[model samples]
Target: MTRHVSTRRAATAAGTAIVAAALIGAGLTTASAAPTAEKTPGASPTKLSASQRAELLRDADAEKARTAKELGLSSAEKLVVRDVVKDRDGSVHTRYERTYDGLPVLGGDLVVHETKSRRTEGVTKAHAGDLKVDTARAKAAPKGARAVVWAASGTPRLAYEKVVKSTKKDGTPSRLHVVTDARSGKKIFQWDDIRTGAGHTQYSGDVELGTKQESSGFSLTDTGRGDHKTYDLGGGTSGQGTLVAGDDDEWGDGTPANKETAAADAHYGAALTWDYYKNVHGRDGIKGDGVGAYSRVHYGNNYVNAFWDDSCFCMTYGDGEGNAKPLTSIDVAAHEMTHGVTSHTAGLIYSGESGGLNEATSDIFGSAVEFSANNKEDVGDYLIGEKIDIRGDGTPLRYMDKPSKDGKSKDSWYRGIGQIDVHYSSGVANHFFYLLSEGSGAKEINGVKYDSPTADGKPVTGIGRDKAEKIWFKALTTYMTSNTDYAKARTATLDAAKDLYGADSAEYKGVDAAWAGVNVKAAKGKNKH
Candidate 1:
């Protein structure tokens, strides 16, 4: 059962200024050095400075007119720059979102690749073909349904996108997007942006946090990382709630019984996640704009779920089962935050195979962030939500090495996978990531044992977690689009691997082998193995 609550806020504006940019200028052949203390070995891409981002953004904007014309876009369509990336070889990739006759065009996003001299190399579009839909106002639509163009799948058509704000039975906040065909007043498609994951105890130990000295003592705001703050939603299920603060800097006694304890855990998770992206992947923040998203704790009594909402630009967690265990574990926090990353990058629609990929992207990064944290109390492992025990049986929520351990998730990709829920469908990529990072068969890391199997009974050798994560991040931000399915995902990762490692490098082979391990084999000639 689900509960419907009404808090009507306008959709996150499509015209919101693009926050991320790149430093991919001509003759930029060398990569920038990582910060000494947080350096990640073999991480080649450079982080963009504020001035560089502005410069690259200007470059992207200046080229949009010519790029759109080359793509054969109609005069009624306009392109807005969403992001930009550059390779070490002096090549640039600019991402854009499309608008049709002043209305947002869902699934009209694209990436234009160019060489050092601005020669058009290629383009990846979420929607192919021309946009010739009639812009005249539809005769009928759902009450308060805002008009837009739906091009994510099938044929492009005028549609209404309605967002219903509510709370799920599991206490997960809902931001359901309901799309209806405007002309016929019929349902076309819908997807919820509120991504949910279950979790266990507050495992983040006595850790360092970034806090600000407020007039009223100290606030849970981290001034260094985009001023990210934590709030206590109390028992209510909506709104931002109150910002958590205290006189002294000391926070939490490592117990969920203390409301401040959960707040501290949430705050710590945000900081660690921020550090992981900035240090490991050179990402500034969730949107790559150096702006932090907030967090809310104690949402709904006995609520056993944690979620990330793009509309509110924040994360919300519930006190699990007995209200004694808050779902603010380190992995859980990273898991939710990574959703925001996926939303901004690939904008993977939260449905079908793309949704599964979206969820897997988060899981992959969440696991990576955990290992990078290297906390003694919360050792990293392939297991997710191992500390929260949301099921009360002391078992984890999901297993990456072999996702079938949960009995609901599939261990490998198969036909009809898109028909299942995204969480379960995510097992395919989750298994792929595990194989890519740790290889097939039995292994142990940080005292956790895992045994992964291949679809064709073939053995796979890992290229290490560090390399695996870098490849995934590159593929996601550079090659992937919203409609990318499992097959497209394989190509994206392979392309990313080729970019980071050479086309003939072992890392590239590892990516192919990992995909084949999960039954996502490449075309005959391409499957060298």
Candidate 2:
């Protein structure tokens, strides 16, 4: 039997404020520079100005000690600050990566929230409880011992085999993660890490790109973000081809007459998406670590798809028909890059309701990025892949207003929704987002006409895209987890709105109404934190 492929197939598989303004300001800095080094135990790294750096170090140390004590961390385990943000009100949110016996602990990360007074408020951990198991006993096979692969759960893990299973129908070997209890050799966790990810000059019209100045002329590398480069695949399916470099910076004309034209479009799309995240959410690049992911274009002849692969931390794009048109439009580029963002954060599982949310997250942000660009040619809208002509006819891949227009997506949520494909199930969240940002009834945004309705027949009042995007982003980063279902999504967005706005604010209520509009009910008695 021929196996089915997800609409979001991978060639492989695969935010906060300062005083509010400061966090946004920090994100606006696009210059490519090495991020602060990960501070080791008892070793302080400088941040901010002299005075502020000292103060931050002191506060960070105290918080780390508090976290270690609260979590009952052993001497071998240490908490290292990855990033820190301070609100204008004095509240501080510090993200940390845990290390076990000087070795990095995959999935062992957490966030520490502290009051302006330097008191520990709470912690959001990726994994629960202390790791009391011995690492020495967790040995791996000689050949399949350890490999870094992308897991559907979000971030990559150091997977080792406790047992190797029989090969699957796909002719791929199955190496189950060895999650045995450190003390009793009992299994603790297990998952398969495989997933797959871009760019341009010819396809995207006339556009400006940020490239790095190299001895071999200027290369298609963005120095402003994380050295993100766009390469020409030379029509081949695999391997990173040559970089689109030249002495003159001007990339392409409108048509794919020149191979560089498609590359120019792909390159420009990546830059815009990077700017969107940085300017809107204060996120610096996909991983939020100031590292730019690379993009590969022209994969195979008439490849028809694009993807974000975490294994290589890059994006890949394919030509549409006869290798003439490439799927490297602004929205499509942003859509692929947003996949990288989802993988690093909430990591909603790649199957079931969570998987739908994962795909919707990309679509939602991809649309937002297009709107942010305000490009006259693309013209931001609620439609996805409208420019790509993926369907041969002029119809877009998916419609945010009425997802069922494609005949496979669900405009609203219902029980057992997880049984459907992720691309189809994602319609529920996409519809919810549209209703929340644009409201119900007939309307036109950026010249695109849309008539959105609620499953409950109760009209919803939109809170504007600006607020809606922030709320969804906050929920994804701070609240939603790998297994968060649709119901949990409702609660998470509500909590996110409460955090950004007040608990009783209009935006908070708008989130609740929006969820109800999608037929996703809020959990009973779930109060805002």
Candidate 3:
């Protein structure tokens, strides 16, 4: 079975598949960059403001021709800037998508880093060399496939990339990207882009919501965070439902019986996620563009899932079993929104090792967002989907402290891990983050007892969650690429640590130790753990 989002398998369940098929018949398609480290490192990194980011983007675009020439690319090859990040020291990291002869080049994304003095430091690329494949050799793409250059993992070749949009059995939308060999028509790689999470009627208690005061009543629109709005999907599986509104500022009674209760949860979750990114990480919004992504609650009847669809750029939550349990939990909301952030920045392709990293990134930030909220009703814990009771067993969907506790996720990295479902494969990074933030060994946090074990039987000393999350955020935004794997992730974090806290700092050592705890060791002679 394929993995869609979060912890569940992707194959629609027995009766669920029929629902999914019916949703498909009605068009239920939904779904869902560079890590780099400083080379000519300077001062402590500070995130760029919205205007600065926009200006840098413009500058990057103006220099595209120069960049192409410096990289010695052919005339047929062109570069389009996807994102640009400026460090506190004036160094710039620019991410770009590539096209060859006016054709999209899959796996052709790359990042170029420039020192403060404007000297090119280095280039991180998904495809290492120039495109040599002949477009003439490309055959017709199957049905919905689009011709392109497959350069994500292996050798650059002519390929067709197709996005299959469908609904999963659990009402989890699937935006599956399937790449096939253009000549042979053989499947090369595939990944589901739809990422999931959820909210109250269960998680957060009575909480304040950001709403717009309309003449008639109050609308579930938060003007403070890019005018983010929440809507009620009613029981339909397609299209955005009506914007949730009320006659007064007050909303929800802390129960699923009140439809506005779910909307309040969803809205509150979006606000928390927005504030967490803006306040802690300096990210203005999911795209760092100050434009908020809306949310949809009460998706399908007993849908049993919540997901983020990049196509609509919105969060969708379902009414879990019997419509009594809404999948609108704080952590789940944060988790799903982080997928949007990942899409805008690292652009991690949703498959294999990269896909695992993609999911782990969301989980990591989801936990961080929860802890940041510090709500009395739902104290922070290193557990995912705990409030939603996704499995009906009163256990979380995943445990970061020890991922294997759930029985499906792997706690450590191993060979062929890329072949497993991404949700399970994400365990390695999740464990690493936990060990990095809280260290290895038995301990209790927020009334939750955890006994984290190391794969190598080595004790890992933590540098605290604050420093840990900072290192991760830097690594993800600066060093990571769509094709980065486990080893690459380790290096990226290490590099991020060196940039943030110095190479000799304990935080850097902690990162190394944490990676080691997950059995992803640094290369020979570079092992500091």
**Best candidate, TM-score:** 3
* Error at 266, model 3, angstroms: 0.9
Cα deviation of 178, candidate 1, in Å: 1.8
Whose TM-score is higher: candidate 1's or candidate 2's? 1
Clashes of 1: 6
Q: For candidate 1, lDDT tens digit of each residue in 159-198? A: 9999998866665657789998877878888888887765
Q: What is the TM-score of each candidate against the true structure?
A: 0.88, 0.75, 0.89
Residue 138 in model 2: lDDT? 38
Q: What range of 10 consecutive residues in model 2 has the weakest lDDT sum?
A: 18-27
Clashes of each: 6, 40, 14
Error of 3 at 283 (Å): 0.8
Q: Write candidate 3's Cα lDDT for 72-161 as tens digits.
A: 679989999998766767777788899998788877888877666566766767666668778885556667778898888678888888
* lDDT to native, each model: 0.79, 0.67, 0.78
